[model samples]
Target: MKHQSSEYVVVIGGGFSGLATAGLLAASGHRVTLLEMQDSLGGRAGRLHRDGFSFDTGPSWYLMPEVIEHWFKLMGTSTTVELDLVDLEVGYRTWFQGHPDPLDMTTGPGAVAAFESVQTGAGVALEKYLAYAETSYGLALEHFLYDGFSSVRSLLNPRLPALLPRLAPLLSRSLDSFVAQRFSDPRLRQILGYPAVFLGSSPKHTPALYHLMSHLDLTQGVKYPLGGFAKLVDAMAELCTKAGVKIVTGATAEGIDTVQTGRHTRVDSVRWSDSRGETHRLDASVVVGAADLHHIESRLLPRKLRSSSDAAWKRRDPGPSAVLICLGIRGKLPKLLHHNLLFTQDWDENFGRIRRGEPLDTETSIYVCMPSATDPGVAPAGHENLFMLIPAPTLPEWGTGGADGNGSEQVEAVADAALAQLAAWAGIPDLAERIVVRQTFGPGDFVNNVNAWRGGALGLAHTLGQSAFFRPANRSAKVEGLHYAGSSVRPGVGVPMCLISAEITAKAVNGIKDLGPFSMDGQNRDAREPEGDVQEERVAK
Candidate 1:
């Protein structure tokens, strides 16, 4: 962990990826400066306080514990000591449209029995599917997750031709078809299928390969940081500081300046605007775009320096945008758990409307996270902190009751409808009256606050073509000393994936080996360690 004075690395965006990237680079001996546009360090993971209610406005569920452990280990710290982790006994509860009782799922393996109770043979089906899912998860971790996609060749191998026969099933079918073929109960299907929306795609469109999420969902189990996602973000920042990474918040990187150094034009400095609107410049040998990749490219760099044209980005399918509502209720929500999924009867129809850029229909699916159920401190005593998310398409216009769709003002309308539906489904008739505080974020807000492209919550869809090496490359072939990370890059989406993305990007930018053959063949790590090391020669195909 020796510091190198010769090279300086400028990491853009102080989000999870930026923090991780800067920390790793600093450990590897590069002078690191992390610039964040917002006033805080955590980008989407930042907290919002309204009327004494605390909210993790973006990510709520902390699914992959191994990723977090591996992250701290890389930083030479203990995750357990730095952050408190708790297993959510009831991982989540589902209020399906027709089901008489809300389905309660636990964090441990006991959830199999619960699924079986819904449908006679569902428990067996779930076990069998998890077995297959585990193998796919191993393959994905081996081939995709750990490495930076520097080139198209990263996605190919000699064994790919052989695996084409085995890949037929996954490549041909959607996640909907994969689970629907195995499970008979509609409730079970919705329960399994609903996670695809978290990745910004519906099960009907998401690739079957993403079934690996099921392995994380039921088998690996859901856990959380005791306080909130803010605690986890704080832990990451603390680790970054200890690793000697300089964090610069309230400073926006406006443009990346490059100089021709032999065969390539290398990024040498960055021009940024500070909180007081004062402009500053920092020189660096390497530049990492930890912010919105498209925004960094189109907004910061000249058109000639950008790797992808505007049309090329439009060609890629941006994932779903969300209409979010954060609330503080006066009384407890007895009918709700820490996590609640309000599934609609017309699930497919809901997805269809969103895909068409239409607003959420009357009978729409809403994901409600009641943090107060898990921690009382998030809200006032005897009160509740509630965060609701509705998946809507990223339309051109966002406003209340516009011809195109509903705007930010329409949040109350939608929240009222969602409350009425929740109360009816959960037998809590007085759910609407308990609200003491409320705030809403629409597509326009995402555009303004986060520089989100078309207000997309997640970067890109994990469709078959959009995933793997088909995504934007980490290393820039057109520009030297430039890299990209976060949801938009390969091994896409999720908070945990961002950690891996930063590791791979740092490896690429810092001129490290990047575990090339090591990650695929699992030749570097010991056999006993089972977090992500894949021992077999199986990767692609």
Candidate 2:
């Protein structure tokens, strides 16, 4: 059942999407060579080491355990074997600006109790909301996420007609409005709406359909990989290597070489520069642009060959950027949990400033991750690992940052303000003095390092028009063998979405279209193989 033909595939960017794409394609009998611009892999899910502390500089919250487990299973392994995942007792701690006591959020009965404490009958309301969320989550996983909307006819599934009534309101309304309809308390609404930030959007702009995100954490509970996100990256890299994919680090893709065949055009090879500034080109029958889609479209591909042009991108929202603060503290912070969120009272105004391209707010929502609480290996015995994220506008005017706050004034100012805010809000007045090591990464770093569009921390915002079939297509309209896989493409951002993007791109390359999730029994078989070939396997399953 293995693929009979093996074509040379070149994957650009060694991020989660790129690494996952390479591994999947290689496993399907393609000779894959992945090029990463950075010295190391992981892209946005990056790790930083300072003093005796290790910080997950990028994504920390490990949501969607099922997706991760599915990915590991696809790679011919299990999550239990590849990762040491710990289910957090407390999902996260939310501290309001003026409130003295912090609210600890957890799944199931604990979550209900927390909500009930805030408002009478809120626990019942929460259960109702979660019921809808869980249903949407299941429906999306079955009918939407895995399927590539290659044709209009693909939308005509029998199940969709019955489900559309339930989904219509979710798609049309904003998440903020949706949550407000269910809960009167602002804290309850904020708790439900804050997940929109993970989608690189504001709750006011994000579709209510994203409420399904709550089901992942509020129902299933939050989990963390013991060694930070780097462990997940390392595991993916190892899988790619095992699948015979050759990974090249410090390789910056300069251009995509193409050749015309009659009326059609296809990618020929990828030309990249190594760390030593030496140029090299490797012929590729197929090319997957798993990096920043904007970077790939604007820089690598030729103007005429580009599927999404600069003009097209200008019309889209590039999403909010962030000022990332990584700290290595000398003492323990018992007040903080493994995950902490400091939310401003005014959610609308805070989001409005970023959406309107206004200046950074004096009072803004910020997320803090203390991974050391769960994993002792991340920091020294007496120290704690702290990572803070302050979401900001993707405006180039905001400037950049560097290690120890040596770079742009604006970037350092934001970091300083965030620290003061954290200290005051969390009741740690000497938090700044406790910092033994510090590093600040700004929007500009996203541009300089990952070639992120408008220095965006995440890719395109998941606005209604920028979602689902409306998102930039995975395969190029002009080029035959050109495909895209990553945050910017269909199925949207996050590590789980990126992994799904990889599978979609891989399946498309193998001539499968509009297919749902792969069956466990058919894991090793080519998806595009004739039905007769896998009939016996299907029967056995």
Candidate 3:
């Protein structure tokens, strides 16, 4: 049966990905309704406030500002309206326990010189490696990321024949192996491979394509909106509303209403519950499940329409879940940057424990976000907003190794130990004493907040076998009108990638061309553009 092109679209999840997809669809002159179970938006990257301090609970750092710019521009909105984007100077710091000096990464020549000083010829090796990363970046941006990935044929396109060779180099070997091949110095290797933790995978499992993150940060630069990461969310949500999209927060989708006729199953409506405990069923021509893909398929959809357990989404390639300790400090640490990393002595063993669902090392590596150093407004005067993340196992059986029996208590204990160790490593005295406010989200929190199966923080780990075309498809093979986006879906994790996931899903539903080249958002990905006409004013909060 033929249908109207301007059919009403309902997005089940209202995270960055869902919101972005709805925005893109609305911009295209389609009626888009976004349903968010939570009271507020931003999902994993949501915000929290206690006393006079404000905390960016999820998505502490904003990498690749250009990707964000391209998104806003696609919606015909200027970035200046929602955020005051600024480039961070001190890239980050890496401490190797007993080293005489801390590895502080500056913007350009200084960083190159620092690497050269650490290892005899690492600067040259880094140059070559970065060149390769740039090639991979261009290839990924132009061919793999921006397009709608449905079948293997999409990747093996005759129009983009050059992709095969580049794809090999990008996904050929492990990022750890690539780093080891390039840099002889262990410290240099650690610094380069450190960011892999954010991808929610061990260095050995993550593909070399992720090495492009180096170029994105060092060359392209790390940026932050004047507000927190939430500013981008606000901006995107505003675009969706201006494009005539309706956003309903605190609305939980309970079930799907479908009609089956012979071979086809058609989605007729959606059953949902709001924060007020009222239930409503709305008719929808097509449904985009922007939440976790696993949840949508396994839990949200009926059993008959679901696929059997696949290794990629099941036991194998499961990503590491994180336990984040977000703190609003009373004062700033003098040596920290907008972004910094405190490395543990044994990263291999650390990942090993996490892979097996064990407690992380007390001296575990921590990614610290100090936005207050760049933009003072994030915290109160003379204070800082910090997020300390320790990636650990999501297994329910993972006990606290004596720190309160259960994983939550264990997470807090380990986080406390991590902060103490961080203070010693960075030479910051009484670091824990200065904390005026603290909030934490462990693997347990991840499950409760987003219905992330098994409390997996980011979706599936970006292992070599589960990359690009290998990842789950945007459109569900089980359900005709149901689509998937966000971290779990292709292209991968992170705020930018989540946005790209939305774009890909939108294109799959509307049969429109995906948005143009965007800077990487979320994990590794291309998000959707706003659907209809871009609007300037803010939506009703």
TM-score to native of every candidate shown = 0.91, 0.95, 0.90
List CA RMSD, all candidates. Answer: 7.8, 5.9, 5.7
**What does the lDDT read for residue 511 in candidate 3?**
57
Q: Which candidate number maximizes TM-score?
A: 2
Q: 1-541 in candidate 1: lDDT tens per residue?
A: 2222335788999888888888777666566788898888777775788777889988998887888787788777777888888778888998888776888987445778888888887888888888888888877776668766565455466556776775678867999999899997778888889888878788998989888888887888888787899988888898888766778888888888899877879987888888887888887778999888889889989999999998898788788887777777888778899999988888788889988887678768989999889888799898999888888788636643211223355655666677677778888787777767777777766777778788887778888777777778776767898988888886688898888888788667545564431121212112122325221211111
CA lDDT for candidate 3: 0.74
| lDDT for each candidate structure | 0.78, 0.87, 0.74
lDDT computed for candidate 2 = 0.87
Cα distance off (Å), candidate 1, residue 194: 1.4
Candidate 2 weakest lDDT stretch, 10 residues: 532-541
Clashes of 3: 27
Clash pairs of candidate 2? none
Poorest 10 consecutive residues by lDDT, candidate 3: 519-528
